[model samples]
Target: MVSTTSKWTWKSPGDETRNQIDCMMISKRYRNALLLAKTYPSADCYSDHVPVVGKFKLKLKKNSKPFTNIKFDLAILKTNQTIRGKNQISVQNKFEALGDAEEVEQQWKNFKSAIMEAATEVIPKVKRKAKQKWMTEEILNLMEERSCSKGNKEKYEQIHKKVQEKCNMSKENCINEKCKEIEQQRKHAPQTMYSGFA
Candidate 1:
């Protein structure tokens, strides 16, 4: 009863004592972003190292859009949609999926909107998002790549400008806001992250 706690002793094979031997094998996969955090093993430093693992996806700069084309053999399809003398579409098949003229017109309008959006409107926004996301990820990845993903500097400032331009953000806020982002990614993501733990 005097020394019950230290009384018991255990022993294992020679390989068991090695530092490289991961008990839970957590580091091997170390994919969880939580485990790599500053307070991973429980937020309370006074308490035990609880090992709370948080996982995230860097998304490879394919980032978020935050956010296809098909063509038939032209000849046959045009014949299928040929119109008549009185501006009436002569459908030899007559198996028109369109219910009514108004409906057809509305459908065409909607299609036009979609096409216009794809060709003109949506492309810009999508390009902006794409550019922004890529720049954001690139900045993050660069800082990540260089281990200097934090701070307000000329290079990063230029990056923020580009990203903001794509996102249509105001110049006033881009510097401060974007810097904050850089800091976050730098602090959380490790140098070895891109390469991996294997």
Candidate 2:
């Protein structure tokens, strides 16, 4: 089959001449899928031959296997002091009771399974929301303003400065709020009090 269009895709540096050395090839079965093919000599690739790019319409197949969700119960270690202590104790006991295996790989796997089992028993799985809870509405507004100011260098810089200031303010506010909460909960053990930071 011949190319749908004629174009020179390459150039010789020594002779200062151009030639169609590069091509965008496709199967006979997907000939209709070739939407556009063109050469760009001024693409700044720093080579003797220019670039030939093609745009094709094709269907992609999805994966057969389901997506695996790996969840870590970090909040249990921070907020649930009782569960944390229990998990730690359980881990220690299981680790100590583990006998030596002939293979280091087997021993490592055993240790991992033991710790996972102990923590799984103590900590409940929680599906966390995919967003930063600390980010304030004011910060969002400033970000929106910055996005709207795109292409205008002066406006972009002004909005970007405002965004930075708002972000700093939001961070300080979150820290101050957490500190106040920790202070209020200071009646409890120091560990639980500082858990607010987590």
Candidate 3:
């Protein structure tokens, strides 16, 4: 017999008795891994039924995939004209030098390796940060204010409007900045730039 704190999992309004509507069961083999199972009424699930949570103690296997990953600086490929041109030429020369092969798959592998080597040499890799630059201080502050005023609907609505306005402004700024960057790249690297209509 399994011993538990509360016997019933659910209850009805009109009915005088409550019944066990939920249960946590484990197989005989994993019975020892079962840690605890209980119900909490103050979990704020917005329902008549309380929340039931269970904890387990089991060992998990680690993933076999390597943690480190090779990163390439693709941004330079478009922005730098010299590196881009030289890298393309190098890749073409390497592919031509490879000549014909017996298997088509082997030929493709050789071509791919040549291109990868050229990219690694011409384009340096840089680590990127996880944080977003577009998330301005005003937006973060407004979000904090909105969260703090959760119970007050009027205040929350006012803050929400301000947050929306700030978000729109931030989006516009980001677009303008990107446009400026593209303009700069086009002006500096005219040879690489293409007229889309042409």
In candidate 2, which residue pairs clash? Answer: none
Q: After superposition, how far is residue 66 of candidate 3 from its true place, in Å?
A: 6.4
Superior candidate under TM-score, 1 versus 3 = 3
Worst 10 residues of 2 by lDDT: 1-10
Q: Better model by lDDT, 1 or 2? A: 2
Model 1: weakest 10-residue lDDT segment is 121-130
Q: Once superposed on the true structure, which residue ranges of model 3 sit more than 4 Å away at CA?
A: 1-16, 21-71, 93-99, 126-198
Q: In candidate 1, how many Å is residue 4 off?
A: 28
Please identify model 2 stretches exceeding 4 Å from their true place: 1-130, 189-191
Score every model by TM-score.
0.16, 0.33, 0.33
How would you order the candidates by TM-score, starting with the best? 3, 2, 1
lDDT of 3: 0.77
lDDT by residue (110-196, candidate 1, tens digit) is: 555444333331122221122433245444444333334336577666665655464444433565665666666668875633332
Say which prediction, candidate 1 or candidate 3, comes out ahead on lDDT: 3
Query: Model 1 Cα displacement at 154 (Å)?
Result: 60
Displacement of the residue 47 alpha carbon in candidate 1, Å? 26
TM-score of candidate 2 on Cα atoms, chains taken together: 0.33
Report every candidate's CA lDDT.
0.38, 0.76, 0.77
